[model samples]
Target: MITYIEELTDQEREAIREAIQLLYRQTYLLERRYDRRTEKYQYTKEYRTCSTHLEFLKDYFAVAGISLEENVHDGIIYIQGETLWGEKLPRLATVYLLILKLIYDEQMAQAASSTRIVATAGEINQKAGAFRVIKSIPSPTEMRRTIALLKKYQIVEPLDILEELNENTRMIIYPTVNLVLSGDHIRELLESFSEEENSGEETAIQNTIEDLSE
Candidate 1:
């Protein structure tokens, strides 16, 4: 390992440093991965760095319990660390993550391709409604705050400004959302949410009735 690290040229070493930092910070590298759009715009030269040295990165990160995953088919390069902060995600964010995954899976089932899954804020809200999860959608400010948390991990990326959000406010829901939470786990959350939503609605209705009686 020492010999291999020594063999790396200054440029290669720099690329490794940037890639490691990117994965450590973002958890997923989408814009950095090679894709059709990456080629069309002819992005900055940093984007041109080939993944030929990825194997070295994999071996190196393993020392720190991080696994560098490269999926050309999915057009993503991400890392999975043993001590990742998956358990710290808030329940609200988890529900949103599951909803996004459900949306992505539904879309993928209908059409299979490398193309990104686009979901509008309305669509996510609708899906949450359909699943009978999240008794009430929080105010846009609170909702965006929750989403911003997931955004830090590169789970759901916004395509437009927060002001433009509505039924038509589209965002690219990354596959990493699924990686963070497994398929079976999401299904379980759905069932749990169903019960919670029902209870919450019943309580709200009873409170309203009591107010009317007074």
Candidate 2:
């Protein structure tokens, strides 16, 4: 593994180092080159570098009991390992994630015939409101932060940032959102939400990362 890593130029080595740091920090890496909606960037080249030196990554992560995974089809790379309940998303982020997963699933199932699901900020707000996942549309600042967080996690892609936080602002919620919440988890969440709706105990909620054992 060291042999391969040592063969790379200093710049390539730095790029790989940065990529690994990012993966460890966010646990997800999405190659912009793979996204048809975005232009190419240095990330894809760096991603290839890591891919070429995959053995190094595997060996490095194995010590920590983390698995380095890549899906060429999805254009995403991620590190999967143990997760603590306390390490999970805050209530607001978790709620938004669930809502986006639901939207992605619904869109894929219909006659749309497209794997990609495009939704406007207003549509998300309306659907989330209808499901009572949130009391109201998140404030612009809050949504901006949430979107940033999601983008970092390879969950969503926003085409334009100039006119963000508005009703017409469109974003592409990736299929990775589905990975965050398994089908069973989604069912459990919906069931829990429904019971809360009847019982008026919206405050009671489950932690997503609680079940992940590292």
Candidate 3:
């Protein structure tokens, strides 16, 4: 529960709004599954629009020296350009990673390979904490961005799994996206980030002073 919000300029808030909107959109578009037994979807079902999620993002970012501000038209949000908290959208990334973790857990339980199962994004969101899954899964664009970020940090990598097709002209193969996570490594990264975030208040104060002077 870190709170990163502070007053922000129109320009900075707009950037934040756009980024969060992108995140919500991307998370919503991920592939998912349906459980006939439950008569409903399993992964993520539905989530708030970008604006709704902004409330939480603003709080999270505020703890890290980044505040959100709305544009004059109130159609956009702005954020500090710097990586105020060392990581961007930490909550969102953590949520996506948690989804991957859940998928891994399910695979292990079923004794199936990653490529052998189909998971719906809806299910993931449902199981996630409100703080994490503010909105449903991200859209494709957001997923791509998340993937890029994960790859950039080497926190996760695309895993290749073998798929097979039967000769009966029936589809028998599941094309699941593979995810790899080194818990120890990821834990270390989070710990370091937490440490950095502890000093976010000081940073925000300094940034505010700079803003005023400018």
Please tell me which predicted candidate would have the highest TM-score against the true structure.
2
Q: Candidate 1: give the clashing pairs.
A: none
Better candidate number, 2 or 3, judged by TM-score: 2
Give the per-residue lDDT of model 3 (tens digit) for 72-133: 22123345535532233344555555455555556657874434333444444454534333
Query: If ranked by lDDT, best first, what sequence of candidates would result?
Result: 2, 1, 3
Q: For each candidate, give its TM-score against the true structure.
A: 0.70, 0.76, 0.27
For model 3, the superposed segments whose C-alpha errors exceed 4 Å read 1-89, 112-122, 129-132, 136-140, 151-214
Give Cα-based local distance difference scores for all models: 0.61, 0.65, 0.39
lDDT of 1 by residue, 132-181 (tens): 77667657876777667766666776776666455676677876655555
Candidate number that wins on lDDT, 1 or 3? 1
Q: CA lDDT of 207 in candidate 1?
A: 12
Deviation from native of the Cα of residue 27 in model 3, angstroms: 27
Candidate 3: count the clashes. Answer: 31
